[model samples]
Target: MHIVLQIGSEITRPTFWLIGPVGKAVFYYLAAVAILVFLAGASERVKRYTKGDADHADRLDDLPSRVVESARTVLSNRTLFDRDFVGGVMHLLVMWGFLTLLIATIILGIDMDLYRPLTGESFFIGDFYLSYSFVADAMGLLFIVGLGIMLYRRYAARNERLWGHHTSLEDDLLVWTLFLLGVGGYLTEAVRIIGQDFPPFETASFVGWAVALIIAAVGVTPELARTLYPITWWAHALLALAFIAAIPMGKPFHMLSSFANVVTRDGDAGKRLPGIPADLDATNAETIDDFSWKELLDQDACTKCGRCSSVCPAKASDRPLDPRNVILDLKTYREERDAGGEDLPIIADGGAAVIDAATMESCMACMACMDSCPVEIEHLSSFTKMNRQLVDQGDVDSNVQNVFQNVMQQGNTFGDQARARADWTAELEFEVDDARETEVEFLWYVGDYPSYDDRNKQVARSLARLFELAGVEYGILYEDEVYDGNDVRRIGEEFLFLEQAGTLVDTFEACEFEKIVCTDPHSFNTFKNEYPEVDFAEFADDPMMAFEIEESWDGAPVYHWTQVVEELVDDGRLGLQGDELAYTVTYHDPCHLGRYNDEYEAPRELVRATGCKLVEMPRNRNDSFCCGGGGGGLWTDFDDEPKPSEERLREALEDTSAGDAIEKFVVACPMCMTMYEDGRKTGGYEDEIQIVDVAELLIEAVEIRDGRQA
Candidate 1:
């Protein structure tokens, strides 16, 4: 048999099987119908998404930036790889290989239909054609390799992430469809090569060449191959079209939605919770239509990889809050609502609610879900919005209600007299300057826990001494400041939070200070991120927003104490004696400071500056476990078994112990100190470990001894 090289012809087999207009017409009809079906399904989803509130339309404004960001997110695949390298590699291979094959198919179509008819010349020829054939063959095999890994993970491997979730039949069907599609494609190529008696140059498609040789050795006649060619060709074409149509019908929709999710994600989502809308009563989302369009879009975007649940402190504590389930449930509610079913409340009366009130309340707003999500879904915001509806309806638990009432009536969660905010000042060696009485360089905003909690009062005093030693001209807001409303807003008490934040911003504007410093990460996050958007005039007439002055508070520069100490140390203003302390210390990253604001290094550097050997917990920095004190978790104990704080303490204890078996568990946030102090006692580690704030540890290293400041 002689081989002929058709160098200037298209790489693909004859379009319409070189048969006639009938075959060409049929292929076009099927392809067009498949495309139309996909668009129809996708359009329905888009309509459902638009049914949500209009706040998310802003995401559509910046086209170029969105495209760049979305492309970067999809191409980098950092979210998956950062957590699990092996799984990330497998996904990257499959994702890129699929894209390459799709591109090849488009090029082939253009070469045959557009270029060949216009110029009577194939665009893919010579070295380019050979390279294309080689790459297509190699990528096909790689695609199969990826599918094999996925199948093994789903069936053979003990993947706990996938085990608990409801694995639908649709998921299995999607995978099998792709697998068979790949096989059919490669087999068709092999059979075509054997039947055509193609040239040696065609062997550049090595996988097809090898398979063709095997088929020839098996005594498959050209006549038999010719008959099989048309069957395999049409089957492969139909399968490809079917895959496209199936994309928007099931879990496969994630391919498109996830990319859009990354592109259109709120830029400052995890950094700041959404502000309560101007019309407080009407803004809370009670049902599918009430949710923001982005929230609705998030439902379609979720891949159900279970990463959020895997890292959730609430889920680990056996609490009702499962981030993954929350997204899935919301998705279900939307689907049902679109199907013309009975209108269902997202947070219903009983435990059987689509998303129960208990589940909404169970979240600690630790932001693990938001951080771990590959598609950048704002899980925390979704839960908070649902909680907002519950709060408006007076459906919150008694403890939560009381906490909200305390903030409204007392300006603090402790329900203490506002005057007592400055009581911690009495313990300092030198009277701390009052920002109300005099202009100061730094206005220290002592948060609720540090001002009222006895254990945290020591931390406040320690920070005061450190400030004095460093000659940092700082003064406290004294009785003038109210709660920062960080956790209050997160807990769904929007009106109460607005009142508190408005009052605080009013005081901040009245006080003459260059910068604001916070003892709590929560307050720091609130002041830095949330307060700037407050419009005080909107609530001026309300009793809770009773401030003498008006005008929206212009944005103020704010710093957490850890940030201040780190800056001071870096600038050589705050000197450490570097006395070698005989203790092993591990630093815990508070949720607000680490994940919410990305200030992990500052606190750790302060710990290292204290002269103690700094040992890291397995999950430190951005991945650090929550201390069960954020998002009103400190105010209302949900009685969750194996408390998150206890779990964290156990992790701290696992670090290699120095003298006295890791003497200190240093923390930066006052809330963290409060949680861990109680955790140390309840976890029975009081004898072995001590919970010390970073400020307190810093003072120990910098404190004056023998009439000289260290």
Candidate 2:
């Protein structure tokens, strides 16, 4: 608003009357050119901030169509939309104003001389275009107000964190400066409007007009207003120029970069994940060890909205990791490097003030934040890579040493043998061992919990019954499978995860399974998405593409128990033998199944097929509250009050439709089973509802029909 009034131009206009059109033309051109030059420099700085090490292949693979679609869904998706609107509304106003202001400046350049002489009639102003001028002025004012609110949010009110505080002095100053730029620019215009009392005042004057009246009422003569206009205008102009120039200097730069980042985002952030290369040349001497500057700087694209922090089970449980800070830290660290500040340790750097080990650990790699982010910042991948650098390439800490030792020597997170991995199968009537030698149609990659946990043993049994009833040629890896280490890798054991994934991949290479499915979503996610990258020297694979391969691999189908059960009903193969076991059950979505993989519907569909009336939880489907077993949370003890699952269970139980209490709460993940069980205990729901796996329910349905058939 201030910039448009051209208060300085009004003061200079009289002087230009003597110099004629040519001199005025030269001055406007120089100012326009100055703005462009500053903008270009800012753009370059943002580019430098996000670039990292060279990716093994193209680091980004999100397709434009998918990115656009996901962005649309982000707005509609309630979970993402809830905590986002305040920030989104403020940000959108500022962003829209930025573009509008740029266009206005370009128009000023044209008005001065680019297209017409400086003496050209001011045809663009006045009541003829009253709506346009009024809108621009209103938007400009709105932008200032938005910036004020944003600054308050970022500084005075902020979330707790691990490394440095969320609000820094520089961040606060940036917001204040941006806000002043808007206010000062508007005031300059108001001064000019009051000085000239121009005929177009009615249209060009909306915001500035009232201020002009106030100045005139104070006995400020037109000549005095004229004198003050140029100084205020120049101050406004200089501040705008400075803000433009400072774009790449700090966190505020995301305002400009977020658009391009969104357009070029990796779509697999929600639908899938990146896959490892299958043909990696382990011996490649030249090409396998580095990440590109762009790849590394990908972290810089973060808006610091803390969406990742909110969904992070680790952070929720008081773990140190915060994805927002991880990106901010890396960006700061990169900036320091560009500034010749690389020699200084990152932790000691000002940027490191926002990042640290706890913030790093708080990330669960659930990708909830990744899916929720409007700009497609890959926080999970960035954090995982940092974990790789610290635990794999750098000196290992004792905590990491302990994890690796347990995984390598013990074969699982709990330091148990593979024998325990199949211990759950012993309770079932069927022998679900490997058919690797017999062209098995399905290879079930059962993870540790389902195998060893007594409660989940029933899930193992239910799935077995469902598969047998469908007459599918599915076989288990039995004792051959090891932990997928998805959680371990996410929790800062990159090398250990690599070792575990490598062992599993090797086993797959030796065996001849047609298709693979795992009861563990983490195992499914890692094997389907991350394992191939165990060796990155050869062909680099995109995880999105890998999903297709995993879907169609070996001409055999891989299905979660839900998918298979759904197929059974679809194919007319389903036979429910049990008496109508009428019970109200509420389903708790596991972060892995619901958020990570977006497999929300299948489990519910399975629940319905059992003829049990489904009692919907308050947070169901994609927005289903997490059970808090993700990111090695099952392994971590919570001495802190209000455990995540206890909170989640309350949400689930609160949604009962009937006066009758919920008798059973079903979940799909072993981790969820563990968590909800603890939640049942903690929430004192142990006497009210039993948390059972969906697989176990299907098993009950099958056994009932089997007896009738007998």
Candidate 3:
């Protein structure tokens, strides 16, 4: 053995040092069996996905883009690091370390078993061997370090997110076994090094060399080391084999399932939503089979990081909704059904149901779960599907029923008559143009709450005045407008949304507009993302209208009014008195605008353009807390205390790193304005913080305050 540099063999270690050919053959057989076991377990889960109702071809159509995006997501660990830095580092280290070690194993296998025999020369010789050993040991150390951190996080520090009902004994054992596997590999290397008298090139294996020194200091002689090398080798190899075999069968399956889920995620998932294509009867989600293959995989992909539940406003507000448990309950039901024909509904009328009705109703459909999820589980889709099932069964509470009826009967959620849709405009001294009759640069889709809710109507009038004062060409649909259906679709009234979308699309067809705009982010989201995908052929009672829509329109560019006002401010068109309306304000990122549409910057810019010191809440942008206004929460009342909006108002008024208690809680969406206003009154924070809209602030600062003045 080469303790120092010898002629040729110093760079590479013996491949089969203590093990004979028979022992090597036995190891190969065990490895092959492990691979087969992994395949059997993984295939079982794959077969379940085949039963899903989703179009497999749709997810697979953009294979290249999916592959690239998935690779980026996995490698960067971007989502993991969003708000939790410590947890992110732990995952990144563990994942990359494991992946690198796996790649090293494959390289060694091909080199020793295939390449050396075929070419009569070692592919992993000299420089390559040294490089491989160095990298492999470093990554092994990283793997061990990461495992240690995770153990500390889970048990010692007791990070609350890591502990939940989803945690099990298997979760604990999985981490320990993986940690031991990495340690065992290092021990095997150290013993081998001692037996070989510690080769000069082997020093490149820094961790193993250090371990070899420690063992030598402990009086383990070379002869004893030689005796223990084979035993240590077999122990490590068997443990590794067991881990491999259990990958898809147990908790580690997240490695494969998560990657697949991320790859198949829709870029516009919660924003666009899945449209019911052929059937107006309604999209059904009675069982796991009703979901898509990607969605089925989504449940399996959950790592139980509790990120979704942790960030969820509904869950934080003491609502029964928990995104992690929702997915876990479905997974349990899926396994039960697959194993022994378990016929229980995923959600049903009583306590016997897999997920409780209260849990289902508590969801705000804010997309926080999906945004916070490292694996892209699409929790909103699951909630929406389950809600659809409830809607189909008429299992929802009375408030939800009334809200749905209001939208169905009166073209809005307030149950106001059709003529009342444009009543807000009566307060404006200037007559707003009917977009249907006038060609305008921007067609404003004045949504339900903005038109009918008094406070929001005041804000809406301010926006109209701003448009007039800026000499911008914009018009509203007036009484012809209906619910934009963003919330209707989220509430699982698919038929209602389709009809509403058809009516709006028909109304849009009559209007000659260059762009679309709205003060309500929900309407903006539907118009920008969902409405474009609405198959009008599956639409309203008018057949001719469908054909016209199909031919004339594919999609439209829709903006939140903040974006328009920000643009105007940038172009010096709003004619603002600089710093005149300055106030310390914190902006509430409407879920539809921030998470669903990625329009965070525009609202903040508008706030800054008013010369206010923009103070941001701890949770802002995609991470912003929801105000409990989404997914029909704005219309349907919840009996729960400390509403999400009220909690958010409290959070907004806290002494942030940037500023102290904010004077104004600025918002861009009408739903947000309404929710926070109500929250302020109920929470007794009305005097502490003012609920104001960006439009209202801009109007006060604008050179002209009203349209009549213009």
Candidate 4:
């Protein structure tokens, strides 16, 4: 009884309120110090992220498209969402709730305690204070619930990604501390309600009243409740301060940065992937030469969510590249370099902790990691830049020599005869390249595949027929066009890519064609995005010449063959011929054509216009599955394993209901078409289905109707 009475004395005395004034002064001072220090540190770190380059090439106009892309990803990659819905929703609620509660917390501090003590009517709407109270209390409750779910998942649920390094003990301690903070806050509210005689606090203080009743049932007197309130409130305030100050050092830092990063993501789906620049370009390359320290700070933006790791094809295929771990590696490297006051070593300096060659080799340059990152961290570009540093500066192991050898001797990855690069175009009635004439309307860039591969020859033939039908005069860079080498550049042969791109740009400069088009998205991406660097040396060069713009003809206004077909159909310049080729077909999205170029709808539109019945695949458009032909994977052997095409083709067949009614698989990419053909053969579905390009489908439709291929 004496202990209870002593506690009551401390609680009810006006002197207990002294803690509020003293605590406020100390806390605010500490908070200002913390914020200032963090601002300096974070600003310094962000400079490292951009590596001292203030010109962020992220292209702000691209942010909306990036958001839409991320939104599209929500449904496609449901694994991340499904596994952590409650935790995620709770997390969002807590985040949003904290913002609202922050306003209330400030109001309580300033109006209730500072402005006019004990006035009780200083709120935004004085008498209707219940609404503010309810919102604050309700959101606070949600914040607690969300934190509770997180704690449960961390300690009890055993989620692999979250606990990959087994820091469960420390993490659990943190979780418990946070939980206690919440509990103490709620208890303080209950105590205050029980002791105070404030009106308009009836139903609004539901949790407080319930907590008061519980304490009363346990034989706790009003004196005990009053005594406990001050201590608990002080403890809660301290915990919250600690949490805020700790923000810059943990994964939760992403809570503040991810939205910012997402808002600044690349929006141009049509912007071609920029290529390595040449000599004259180097003269104006100050932005590329001096990378800012902020370039290095980009590591801080990572949430370490592991969503990138889950979708990584390289990791899935048993390679060493875990994109999440790569970001972690960068973070660790940055920390050690800064702490030691030493220059970051060429190979991520650390004993027994450095990333190795085997780990880097596992990356197929797929860019899926970059695609999935919620923070828009650009892991692909970072990794490639590191590779550039490694090979050029560190003398690290690489396939660069082999790539050069292939391009120099064979002119392709397959080491096929360079002479045969234009074999498919041998039968074309028109001349391949007659730059001397200089009056062509279209410059058809017949890339290595459609020009050589017998299977892709049909696409070449269809393109010719379509051109003839449209009365579009087009020229081909037959022998003049060597490999554009975007894949080679991405895989770290930057020099070779520049040389090849340089040659292509020179050839285009000499040509008189009004417009250029290519069947290959890779070639299109290269010529349109990279080759133009030769002209402007700073900005993307326009592939379309003046006549093409005026007459709409010179630059490489590249499109998937389907997009061209759709445009032709829309203009009434082209139409489906006979009903004989009509069958239920499904379209597969190639990573380069679908995700890379934003050509999802145009291909679907073309397929629908073909007069064939169309069926939807479970993973179509931006959500489409990779056909395993991208990032030079089509040519490189993967552990002597069966082709990725076999698996992808099997998936497509299942989607098209090939066993039921579909007789053909229509594709727009030459690589995809080749892969599907191989897939059909390997999967024993050759007799069941035939794979053809959308151009071929149009040709078949037209030939069956007009008796001419177009």
For each candidate, how many residue pairs have backbone atoms clashing (under 3 Å)? 0, 31, 0, 34
After superposing candidate 1 on the true structure, give the runs of residues whose Cα lies further than 4 Å from its correct spot.
1-21, 164-166, 214-223, 280-283, 349-352, 655-661, 704-710
Per lDDT, what order, best first? 3, 1, 2, 4
Worst 10 residues of 3 by lDDT: 543-552
lDDT of 4 by residue, 457-478 (tens): 8788888787777666676765
**How close to the true structure is residue 379 of candidate 3, measured as C-alpha lDDT?**
83
> Considering every candidate listed, which one attains the maximal lDDT?
3
**In candidate 4, residue 362 scores what lDDT?**
55
lDDT per residue for candidate 2 within 1-710, as digits (tens), equals 12234333332222232233675565566567766876787767655534434444453465666557645644343333455677667776776675676676666556645434555555344343455556668878778777876766765675443124354666666778878877786777677766665536454547777667777888876678767876776677667766665666666666656644655555455323333334333211111123345444455566566666666656666655556766666666555656775343333112333244445544555566675565667666555554544453343444545656777787776677766677777667677657656667678777787777777767777777678778888777767777778887676564456556555665676677677777877776666656544453222243312111222112234456676567776676767632435777888877776767678888887777777878887656655656666766566554535677777666656655742377788888888888889888987877767888888777777666666679
- Please list the Cα RMSD from the true structure of every candidate, rounded to 1 decimal place: 2.4, 6.5, 2.9, 6.6
Give the TM-score of each candidate: 0.95, 0.79, 0.94, 0.80
Model 1 lDDT tens row, 49-126: 777887633677788989897898788777888677877877877888788899989988898889988998775777
> What TM-score should be assigned to candidate 4?
0.80
Error of 4 at 182 (Å): 4.6
What TM-score should be assigned to candidate 3? Answer: 0.94
